[model samples]
Target: MSLKSLGAKIFAKIVFNRIQKWATNPVETQQKVFEKLISEAKNTVLGKDHDFENITSFEDFAAKVPIRDYEELKPYVERVVSGEENILWPGKPLYFAKTSGTTSGAKYIPLTKESMPHHIEAARNAILCYIKETGKADFVDGKMIFLQGSPEMQEKNGIKVGRLSGIVAHYVPAYLQKNRLPSWETNCIEDWETKVDAIVEETKNENMSVISGIPSWVQMYFERLQKSSGKKVGDLFKNFNLFIYGGVNFEPYRAKFENLIGRKVDSIELFPASEGFFAFQDSQKEKGMLLLLNSGIFYEFVEATTFFDKNPKRLTIGEVEIGVNYVMIISTNAGLWAYNLGDTVQFTSTKPYRVIVSGRIKHFISAFGEHVIGKEVEEAMNKAISKFNFSITEFTVAPQITPSEENLPYHEWLVEFDNSPENLQKIAEFLDLEMQQQNSYYFDLIEGKVLQPLKITSLKKDSFQEFMKSEGKLGGQNKVPRLSNDRKIAVALIQIQPQN
Candidate 1:
């Protein structure tokens, strides 16, 4: 091993022990975070508006500050955007993470000086934890590609604004600068397809070992690399061993990824967002990402089933239970107080608080009362694909309330296959059976004749990529929604279909 690799090994062990203190004292760590956030922001406008000076406990904070998503909190954000100080956090925010929103056009999420370290450190620790557990730090000596957005930033008011990935690109550690691949000019390519072409040209012969990105976009890169070099990714980058990803569940794409790489690589999962870094895979043996309790955020859980009720009960870490799906709410050092993050999670291990991202609260098919979620569909499809030895490029689930035929409403899965299966009929039945087994409401609906078994609609290859490009969200943090309540995305997909 090189000197750098040996140093990383030593650093990994030290970091592991430091983080273990917080993991063991989850409740106490969260309490300390809560107190620090309240104390620090008590004089700010949002804090004053919510009477934070008098707040002494989680109950007091909850009662004083109602939960608000980006849209609801935009008034304060707008003030900050227009150069106001102490509107959200203490003074002016260091930067704004610009991301596309659904109902709201573009969202500008603040990243404060106090909060930025949480995002950077958690990512670093994910690698450290992996190295410490598996005792494999040799990848540190080889080329690493993050497969991120353009690092070029545009000034919004006085703050630098860009995609979160792009903003983070500016912070690559000095040590890894030599090992990081794809020259800066290539990374700045505005167009994703053009960027991938540039990346292939630059790194096709490099000793790449670690690759990180959203699975959908990274798949595009792998396909391009294979097309150009006529070699599987594993052969092209023989040293490549670690795959890191977040934003979407990797299970659905596992088979396709293994085929592209021609081998299985050790992987680490992360649960991060524009607001804060929440969790990361700490142990190779663990099923869920270890929740960052001592990070600069205080977490709350509202039961997903009752989230829409007039008044949903918000529970802290002490009150959360294993296996119960909850909409994750967070109050962060970045000045977001009781913010509803729109994501749902299930605690797989509450001892040290490990969670799996279950689904998005707003991203589900509840057209009927079946209320099928992202996790259920991904799990059901994963099983069916594994059983049939089939692999898919991309897929999404939406309710088809108005079928072309006189049939009952059903969930329509638009799938883009890596290789078309010969027995699609059998695969459909298997997928439907798996879905029925997982969801009781869906099973009851099917038995009551209110809904038919799920149907698969095969899409032309690269349909999702084409869709994302047309929508101006081809790469970076953008991802196709896995589940939708309505047929908006489904209708859009139909329009993009090629005519014979």
Candidate 2:
């Protein structure tokens, strides 16, 4: 190993040891974090509004501060946006991470000085954990590139504002700056297509060892690289061994990525949002991400099934169980109190409190009482793909409630395939079988003839891309939802182009 790699290995050992402390004392660490968040923010606007001074226990905190999504939390966020000090946290934030919201248009999430370290450190330690486990830090000597939003900033009330990825681009640790690829000018190109073109030109011949981004966007870059160099991405960047991704489930895209790169690379999964960086895949052999209990965020879990019910019970770290799907609610140092981030997660390992993002609370199909989640569908899709060795570019599922009188209503799958399967009906049957195996309710629905086997509609090439482009979200952090309860996205896809 080189001097740098040796140094990284030593540093990785230190971080790994530190992380082990909380792995054993997960609940205790979280309780301490909870107390700190409450005590520190007791004087802030949200803290005062929620009677934080009187809050003593988790139950008290839950009772006083009701879980609020972006819309409910908007009034206070607006105050902070208008240059109000101590509105959420102790003072005005250092940055506002501008993100596209669902109910509200654009959400400006705070990034306080106190909270920023978690985001940065969690990501760093994830790599350190890998280095410690595998004894592979040679990638540190080579080029690294992150496919992300522009680094350009727009000021909002004296506070800097940009996409979270864009804001993070400005803070690439000093050590990695030398190894980081894609020049500042290339990253600053705002238009997605133009920026990608610039990135391809700049990094095509570079010694790239690490490539990180959302899967779909990175696929585009890989394709572009392949086209330009007439070689698989793996061949071009032979040293490229680490793939880091966040935002969406990577299982469905794994096959396509494997084909693009011509080989498999070790991957690290991250659970990060504008609110906070919650978890990261710490062990190569582990099933789920190791939740950051000692981070500035205090987490709560409401069972996803009862999330919409009147007064859903919130569970603390000690109260959680393995395999239970929960809507992850968080109160963070960023001053987001009892915030519902919309993402639903399942606890895979309670010992260290590891979680897998199952789906979004607002994004599931329950039209026929056979509630289907994103994780189930993605797993079923992967199963079917693996069985058939088929090439799927992108796909989504929605309920076909009103079908022709001849057929029962079913789940409609719109698939964009890189290489269309010869036996579409067989693949559909396989997908349906896998889905039934995964979800018992779906099994009942199929057995009772409440719904027919899922129907697959092969979409024209680039259908998903066209839909995203039409929605003004062709690139950056934007992603097509894997499953939608409604036909909004399906209808929009239909309007965009032809389907088979």
Candidate 3:
């Protein structure tokens, strides 16, 4: 084995030991983490303002600090953006990760020198934990390509600003750089399509063993590689075994990915955001991801069913129960206190603190009191795809609140297909039925004549591409909303060259 592989295995063993200790008693681990994080930041401007010095417990912290979103925290973020030192963190931030906003305008999230290690360490531990669990280290000896956004950064008030992928690019360790593909120069290409082509040319014949990126962009790269090599991805790189993906769920695209690769490979899911790296798939034996208890972020959960209540019950890690959907909140080393990150998840296992992403707080359809979320939509789509043997390149669903004066309001799916199904109507009917099976409220609405059967608007080829391009959101961590509460996006989608 190579020296690097041996060192990596040694590191994995050490990290796995720590993971075992942390997972032994999640409640205690989280309590200690919260105390440490709070004590470290209690002297910062935000901490001082919130009386963190006097806060003695989780309940005290929650009572002192109100749950806030980006808008509520905009003033502090703006201060940091304008070169204010020690406003949020101890000093000027190392960088700011610009979030691609759909509803609110783009947000600039601080990444401190202290917090940067959390992102790096969590990522390292994710891979290392996987190796320790599966007893595989050969993948580390070969090249791994990260299909990420442009690493090129811009300065804002002398503080660097870019996407999270760009920041991560700047921090790739020297040892791994030798086995990483696609030169740094190529990674700087601003246009995604052009950059993807460059990446295909650069890594087509390399000894690639692992590939990581958001599923959709990586799929584009794979397609280009297949056309150029005239071979399936598995044939092109027999060693390619691990796929690390985040930013979106991979289930809907799993079949298509396997079809392109000509085989199934081990994959790991990550719950990472601009705010923090929250969790990762730790064991193939378990169903959901294991939350990182010792990471620099302290977590809280507010029941999603009562998220908007004036005084919603806030629960700590000790209080969380399996099967309850919760809106995740965090107080991190980056000076965010009780900040709501807008993602929702449900605990599948509380003993070791494992969870599955349920949906985003903003991405839900409830036009007729039958609320449906991303998880339900993804499951229904996966079922339809599996049974129908079709492929979806991209899709989004929105409530058709006013179908017509005579027609009852219903859901409309705007889908872009790589391989169109034999009968689009049948697929649509199947999805509708699947959704009904998932949500009884939706089923009742349909049966009570309050809602019409779901409708399908098979989008013209490249319709999503045109829409994203027109909006200047065509690439780099931007994704179409899987579900929306209103028809604003759906109406605009229909105008984007509908096939029908």
Please provide, for model 3 over 1-500, each residue's C-alpha lDDT reduced to its tens digit, 9 standing for 90 to 100.
Answer: 87777888899999989888988888888888888878887877888998889999998998899999988988888899999887777888889999865558879999888788878888778899888888888999889998877888899999999999889988888888898878999999988888889999999898899999888778888989999999999999999999998888898889879988999999988888889889999987898899988888889999988999999999988899898889999988887889999999999997788999999988899888887999899989998888988887788999887767778988998888886766999998999999999999999999999988898888777777677778887767877788999887787888877344
Q: What TM-score do all the candidates reach, one by one?
A: 0.99, 0.98, 0.96
Backbone clash pairs in model 1 (N, Cα, C under 3 Å; residues 3+ apart or in different chains), count: 0
lDDT (Cα, 0-100) at 245 in candidate 3: 89
On residues 4-76, what C-alpha lDDT tens digit does candidate 2 reach at each position? Answer: 9999999999999999998899888988999999999999988898899999999899889999998998999
Model 1 misplaced regions, further than 4 Å: none
Descending-TM-score candidate ranking: 1, 2, 3
Instruction: Tally clashing residue pairs in candidate 2.
Output: 0
Give the count of colliding residue pairs in each prediction.
Answer: 0, 0, 0
lDDT of 3 at 70: 89
Clashes of 3: 0
| Every model: Cα RMSD to truth | 0.9, 1.1, 1.7
The regions of model 3 sitting more than 4 angstroms off are 102-104, 498-500
Taken over the whole model, the C-alpha lDDT of each candidate is 0.91, 0.92, 0.87
